[model samples]
Target: MDITQTTSVATQAAASSADKSAAAISSDFETFLKMMTAQIENQDPLDPIDSADYAVQLATFSSVEQQVKTNDLLTALGTQMGGVGLTQAAQWVGMEARVAAPVKFSGDPITLSPNPVAAADEVNLIVKNSQGVEVQRQPISVSNETIEWSGVDRSGTPFVEDTYSFYIESKENGQVLATSTVEAYGQVTEARSQNGGTILVLAGGSEVDMASISAVRRVD
Candidate 1:
């Protein structure tokens, strides 16, 4: 169904699998111990099993048990971490975040953080739509500053409210100096976990990984 529903199902399935695995391991261990006891009891009196062999078997069993316990603990820890992630995600719901990824332009002016190369004499901000088509381009200062886009095309015509990406090109005397990294500020509308990681769903349907967020601030 929806992403949130899918994530919930996945989490439940993982917890169930962990529980089943722990149960199976415990059951198998009990069977193994019983089998070993039967072997020792039915051993020949004159040709008894070597004490060294018994010790080795016991050691192996202990190792397996320890490994199973470790797995159980790790599984529990993962579940706990997932809960903590959800709690943190809930806190991000109404806050603005600067993420190192493309952003959605919803007719409102969006702020972009651009980092220009140290030696660059000129910097330009390139705006691209979801289809990777350049819609607007403008010169910017060669400094680490935030630029705002009015969601308009070159002709001053406003672009339809939708998701758009941005890129920054730094040049020095017509030669390309660097293509700097761009960060977009957006509001987090929702959050979901997929593939063992948290993803923030922003306004205008853009999604970004929680780890990709560089900064967070109140949406005043």
Candidate 2:
């Protein structure tokens, strides 16, 4: 099913659950009230029940009723929020999201955003294949905001089409300082709600949390 339909069904389920809980709470409350009334009416006239005892009973029931109502309202609010999130996430489909993860390469150059350490004097791009095997390493400009990777190997040959990861290896005085993955843009093919959060599926069928997306843009 599509995202919108899936979310609607989920919301309906939550609403039904809330309705059932409210009904059960109401039934229990009515029974409590009826039993209390009967107790009061059948109390011995000479030794009538203490007014303080009745007050305590009423106060306790009132608290329980209030708590149940509060829970019902909260459940409804959560359902509403989930629907809103799914609606927003559905709009992200067909767009390109910038994230730090492996991306599938199919002959087209991929744009990468490298973040190198500030203290490093040199930075190199490290390319790894799906199996985490290093395939290419080349020096890159430190000040470049974005780089279009040609998906080529060190021997100047095009790599076989597959999922690949890119990293920025920062060095100072020939000593490695830090290595961090670079963000790349990938088309978002699907979106869904999982564990109360939105997840986006990229073109390669990889799933990423919506919160991890650094930027989005329409596919050129």
Candidate 3:
């Protein structure tokens, strides 16, 4: 018979139960009774099977029934936990986050994009360390959308790998012009099982899942 057509866990348990009942009472319980009677009639009557063996069969049936119910309960719990994880991912849609990152900033090839499109003259970028010390000053010549720097100092020396902010200025009179705007880039802080798998949103603008991440960083 087809064994997997049952609906509810109770129904599946019942079907398995019926199959076991059929095996326990193969052709008929009456046939077993009749055969036992005939065997008793033909035997010497002192070597008959003990009555306790039948009680053992009843105990086995009870154990199997309880096992099927327990399995069903566990399956339900797994489905519930998966739903809870998805809900947590939804809560991280707009939160700001910084992800794990291996920074690869070469002081010799540092370049930043142009903020104001119209002003395409020479702009100066001043690099300052965390202690507010002026470390490097270079003239960034802008012609198009981005300003490319050779990551060199005023004396044409390469910069060391560290966190620093730049102050862009007008190269004519050496006055500060435009400040920098840092953007957040990080991995998905959350995930969920949507139609099938999951969807994720980073701290910035990109919408990716748990799998699309290569690295994370918070560059200001």
Candidate 4:
């Protein structure tokens, strides 16, 4: 296994074990104190408990208690570090991430990253409105290069300001081969952690997991 994976597993196991161990140690310490007190109180004055033996028992319990405290501190520190990790993820804000999410049109050209199929001889850009209606269809180059899409209709009239989805329709000899949702670069508005994974909120209020990000770049 990878070292990072092994370390993560070990850390999680240690954290879980620490909590259980702390509880058990606390119970044991209480029992030990009660037993010691009962013995001291019931002992005869002539044959009293030796001070040296009592010291040894006290020192042992003290060491065990200290160990439990140390474990508790480690657990707390782990939690703090997890929070710090999310703080670091905040740096992703303001950057552009390539994701397959709707692009919010607000009187600005949206850049789309369309990936046409290799077997496609022709490709067409299919624009869908917020209500899932096909608003426009136009031919586009069958290449992986980014395309700037103006949020307008065939007559060069701007559509209503709303979220729009783009799909790439691939065809071979006028027969539709496949249509797939295209990815677009959207600026990150926020970064947060959820369910042990990082999530990036796009400018259009769309949330995507870190794993869904295809590429990231500066908003130049």
Candidate 5:
């Protein structure tokens, strides 16, 4: 099902659970009250039950009842927040999101965001296929920028269609400085709630958490 429908189902399930809990709490409260009343009515006239003990019992029941109500309110709030999250995630569909993860490359070129170390004088972009084998290496600008990969190997031949990952290595005067980070771009094809969080399904068949997206832009 779609994200909206999935969220609705989850909300309904939470509401049903809350309703049952509330009902059970109410029933138990009523039974306690009935028992307390019976005890008071059947108590000895000369040796009546201590009023202080009854007060304590009543106070405890009141606390439990209040807790149950609080739980119900919190559950409702959670459902509402889930709905809002689903709404926001839905907007990501059909958009391109920049995330720090590997992505699939079918014939289309993939965009990579390279973050180079500040002290480095040179930066290199390393492309690796799904098997973790280096396929291409190219010197890139030292500045943090987005670079496009045409899925070609070192010999200028296009790599076969598969998932690939990118890494950035920064160097200073031929000595390695630091291995920087790289971000991948993908088109969001679907959004859904999973395990109390929203997941963005990319067109490349990869799933990413909504919170993991660093940047988003509409697909032209």
Candidate 6:
């Protein structure tokens, strides 16, 4: 990932290319070994190159060869993972998704979708703040329906421009009933791997970790 490592990789790639281009490189490798052995065998009686020095070069070459192979395998695995993410992206096309985003206050009532499985009979929406404090609560009639928020706080004060969270609940006979789920909806712009997992980035500048996905649909 550093400059020196990148340069080393480039150098190794050039070496690999050269080795492949020289079709008889394996025979050449054997020839060099034989020549070295023959020279040592015929060396003068008084002077000889150190056999230990040749042994060191052989060891270094072996390590470098293995490293080049490892790099190639890793590059191949990355390509495979990218292909898998593309296949998964096609699964989320037409399904209605409930993404958690604050409804922009335009004086229009906010509408929530896909009612809770627990208490879908009498639905209610609870708005919470960043601190998880319930700032507003309103009773609604449908679980899988949408309700607009006027951006007003519990005391009927117009809320400021900031992010908020909402939870849909169902209550019957003054008792809690069920809870609904919320999901974000958008086209998958791209899929990428991060921290060993794939993430799908949607059209609204929001990112969804693949593990968080609950449903998928195909659309034209």
Ranking by lDDT, best first? 2, 5, 4, 1, 6, 3
lDDT of 2 by residue, 30-123 (tens): 9998999999899999999999998999899889888988887787788778778778878989998899988888889999989899988999
TM-score of 6: 0.45
> How well is each residue in 98-212 modelled by candidate 5, as lDDT tens digits?
9877788888888888888889998889888778898878998998778788887767788898877789999999999887558989888888877777888887577889999
Q: State each model's CA lDDT, in order.
A: 0.82, 0.87, 0.48, 0.82, 0.85, 0.58
lDDT of 6 by residue, 1-220 (tens): 5323433554465556656644444665677689878888998879877879789867876676666666656655554554465455545543333455432333434435545655346667777754567777777666454555666766778865444567777677667776544542334555555655666665444576777765544423
Q: Lowest-scoring 10 consecutive residues by lDDT in candidate 5?
A: 2-11
lDDT of 1 at 207: 84
TM-score of 4: 0.65
What digit string (tens of lDDT, one per residue) describes model 1 on residues 101-195? 66777678988899888889999998888788888779988888787878877678999877778889999999998775588898899988766
Candidate of highest lDDT: 2
Deviation in Å, model 3, residue 165 alpha carbon: 21
The numbered model that scores best in TM-score is 2
TM-score of each: 0.86, 0.87, 0.32, 0.65, 0.86, 0.45
Which residue segments of model 3 deviate by more than 4 Å?
Answer: 1-48, 97-190, 194-220
Model 4 lDDT-worst window of ten: 1-10
The alpha-carbon lDDT assigned to residue 195 of candidate 5 equals: 74
By summed lDDT, the worst window of 10 consecutive residues in model 3 runs over 1-10
Q: What is the per-residue lDDT of model 3 for residues 106-209, given as tens digits with 9 covering 90 to 100?
A: 35343444343244356656666545577766665553344554556667677775545455555334444455432223434444454433456542234555
Clashes of each: 0, 0, 3, 0, 0, 23
Clashes of 5: 0
